[model samples]
Target: QSYIFYGPTMSPFTAYLIIRGISTLEIRIRQQEKNALKVAQFLENHPKVERVYFPGLDSHPQRDLVKKQMHGTGSVLSFVIKGGYAAGETMVNNVELVTLAVSLGCVESLIEHPASMTHSELSPEERKKSGINDSLIRLSVGLEDAEDIIDDLKRAFEKV
Candidate 1:
């Protein structure tokens, strides 16, 4: 597909890099998952967080299904801040360690606001139908120590 625009296929060196990544993928995922669960729990109990939506959490609506089919919950989560768009913007702006980025699934933590970022093109009704909100924030946990991530979040929360 579209091989001419890109290449006939991936170069040998790129394939080798992907193969190398595959070797440690599982370990990386597990560590990210662990960090995510901790981050989720912290958010769930925080006064500033209105709701947390990580499948690893006991409070997750699909917890039963998650347990049945998944060995571990992946490292991404979405949550609602107690305040709306302004608060979301403040927290993201204040982040010192976590990066405010649209790209995720990385070695470093990343955060984004779907209402204004990924789903910005959608109209109000469309956004409502898709469940994206002014306060909704997505976080992709990374390889950092869980405490460090929490501390970064706490600093951000103080601004909100």
Candidate 2:
């Protein structure tokens, strides 16, 4: 019963899994960053995207500082849709390949609407103050083929 209350140690299999993950961490991260940059570029030029918040993009306000401080821009990015909250929801709903989830930095692409999902508890004013607009959408780019990710987002954008 005491053992059940709190595990004395993690399983060997779990430890092995952790080690295996660490072994490929660098490779996976490189691929994820590459994919994220491609996706960010696409979103930056997309008509439906009001603004893309990826530091890798030349248009990003902090692009110079980001380049100075970071090797890669990172796998997660956020954007504001041209339409409002409903547009964000509709686009996310229409995605075929990207999964809708609040969790990020996984092996698979994930998308979320902060206003309605992660930061839903905040009042409109509070959300606005935090720069989480109604049309804001966050995406965690994965290791999937960049074209496929762009295609998936293109299809979703059409619905907005």
Candidate 3:
């Protein structure tokens, strides 16, 4: 037996256009990866950051595997703040260049505190089981200058 279902507004033309835009998309992705790695490194050395999770970092346990399998590490990273949940909230609120939004893979930087924003519905035990702690702050590095992004994070950390 064979089965097929159609969505309410699937657009073949839009899909075709997106397929044709792969080259430009790849260039943006490369730049994002570079900027993300830079920001991750910056955070790793920051006094207020307890830990950084980025596949591109040497400290990541799977870094070798990631480098072997992927063209480049993606543009997202997560770090735990020293002050836990309150510090995470403060950093997200104070960031000017990095918007405090849940969505990712955009042209502008985005940040969110998953414990309070994305996965708030989950109980503390559930969130911890999923490796999301109260201090975790997710950052989606965008197509901005690496230094500018780092500067934004620095200012936010100061407020924290």
Measured against the true structure, the TM-scores of the candidates, in listed sequence, are 0.90, 0.92, 0.87
Predicted structure 3: lDDT: 0.92
**Over all chains combined, what TM-score does candidate 1 have?**
0.90
Query: Among these predicted structures, which one has the highest TM-score?
Result: 2
Q: Which stretches of model 3 miss by more than 4 angstroms?
A: 1-20
Task: Give the per-residue Cα lDDT of candidate 1 at 12.
Answer: 96
User: 9-114 in candidate 1: lDDT tens per residue?
Assistant: 8889999999999999999999999999999999999999999999999999899999999999999999999888788878787888899999988989999988
Model 1 misplaced regions, further than 4 Å: 1-7
Off by over 4 Å in 2: 1-7
Q: Specify the poorest-scoring 10-residue window by lDDT in model 1.
A: 1-10
On the 0 to 100 scale, the lDDT of residue 134 in model 3 is 91
**Per-residue lDDT for 122 in model 1?**
93
lDDT of each: 0.92, 0.92, 0.92
- List of clashing residue pairs for candidate 3: none
Residue 4, candidate 1: Cα error in Å is 13
